[model samples]
Target: MTYSGDVTPGGAPAVRELSGLTVSKLSVGPMDNNAYLLTCRSTGDQVLIDAANEAPRLLELIGGDGLDAVITTHRHMDHWVALEEVVAKTGARALVHADDAEGLPIPAETLTEGDTVPVGDCALEVIHLRGHTPGSIALLYRDPAGTPHLFTGDSLFPGGVGNTDKDPERFAALIDDVERKLFGRLPDDTWFYPGHGKDSTLGAERPALPQWRARGW
Candidate 1:
């Protein structure tokens, strides 16, 4: 499919095919959180990112293919409302950043920056972006034949970074981490999927960084 990244609650997911894996983006819940299901092409092994809501739908989306892990991008309740039920049903390994692990109702394996999450024959590298609840992470998948693809959970979006509650310190920390850890390291062509709404490439959002910073959101 085209992978427009525009998804709505109760709508069909948008699918993106890469060299080694497939990314299926589904929106669930009243909050419109985005849940990503990645399947390894070689092994059909899959991992879900953010089981945000609607346990039955998530389980249905997963189908009989089964799941290997469910990776929560952060501790935000809106981001993991369906986590426990989904994990219980699939027996998938539950994972979250150590800083936000305690916030989850279910116990999860703690992750840190530089951690590698396995998916069948593929792997996703973790990039910790703080200030969006202390343990927000973005997953990076470097396509062997293409550019890097990022799964940014609430830490970044098309117009700006995640909310910092108007706290200058937190805002600064978030902006700094986003700039240094994300924009600086990845190429402009890198396509990123956010927690909600449409996806965008670094090139599309690069010019607005200063604006986002100046506004201090």
Candidate 2:
């Protein structure tokens, strides 16, 4: 079924129609965190990243067909609040980092760096980016046409970085990882779908690395 449009109380789920898939960016809850639904355009198989709040609306989006999997970027409540309900409703397996796995309300398959998750014909490689939380991860997948896409939760944003107030050391490490593992390693053309704001490219954020490091945030 085609998504009608964004629903109220939460910003509309802005659907980005890609080559072989459709990504719906749904802004939910008090923090206005962005949750996404990546579905294969031809097969309709889907994987949801984060649940945030707005359980009712998210349920509507998932509809009757069960979700392939539910991936949590980290363990924060703002990003995972509706996870249990979504998992129960769709019977989808919850996947989270090994460090954050213990904190999830429901059981989840612990994902570590280098593991791959399949959604339809696409494979998402788990990249451990440990700044937002100890187990924070970003999923890197390629579209049918072989274009790279990175789903970075709160670890990295358009111009901002994930809040590191909880653990300064971890945050510092996370920033370094983003630079070395993400920005430095990924292809320049990779599409970055951040957790909070507008989508950016690896090339777009590369130049600002110096500024990010200097700001010390």
Candidate 3:
């Protein structure tokens, strides 16, 4: 099946297979949080993005492969509701941005901009995006034979950036960081998966940057 990136809570997950990596995305929790299970095709090394909620379902996705680590994009409760459970079950290393680590239910190793987290033979580069939260991050996986794939937490979405709680400074910080760190560096074909709802490419949303900025969301 084609990877639509349209997943609903209690519905089936959407999957995308690349040259050396395979990503399976499932939505869980009342907030419809999206959790991604990344498997390195070569070494079968697996990593999960956002434990979110529904520990049993998330565990089912892991099966016998076993998880190497779980990366929490931010410290938001909806993003880590099942984090403690998932970590305890898999014994996977919990990683979060330095600023958000203090807010987590459990202790986590901190991540910062330019840092790389290894998944078997593959690695994800961390991009710290502030505003929605002090240490919000986006993970970038540049497939050798395919286009770039990004896992953006609540910092980015299809229509606009994440909620900054109506603060001008925070809104400004978020949009600027997103434009500079993401749009400025990545190509139009880069596919990004947001925290909730459907996914979209940077090209599709690029034309509306000015509008999103003007509205101050």
lDDT of each: 0.93, 0.83, 0.95
Worst 10 residues of 3 by lDDT: 6-15
**Rank by TM-score, descending?**
3, 1, 2
All-Cα superposition RMSD per candidate: 0.7, 3.0, 0.6
For 95-181, candidate 3 gives per-residue lDDT tens digits of 999999998999999999999999888899999999999999999999999899999999999999999999999999999999999
- Clashing pairs for model 2 are 6-12
In candidate 3, which residue ranges exceed 4 Å CA deviation? none
Worst 10 residues of 1 by lDDT: 1-10
Which runs of model 2 end up more than 4 angstroms from their true locations? 1-9, 144-146, 166-168
Candidate 2 lDDT by residue in tens digits, 147-215:
688999999887867889856686679889998888778788888887776788888788888888777
Clashing pairs in 1: none
Candidate 3 lDDT at 180 equals 99
Candidate structures ordered by lDDT, highest first: 3, 1, 2
lDDT for each residue of candidate 1 in 104-215, tens digit (9 for 90 to 100) = 9999999999999999888999999989889899999989889999999999999999998999998999999999999999999999999999999999999999999998
Distance from true location, Cα of 5 in model 3, Å: 0.9
TM values, all candidates: 0.98, 0.91, 0.99
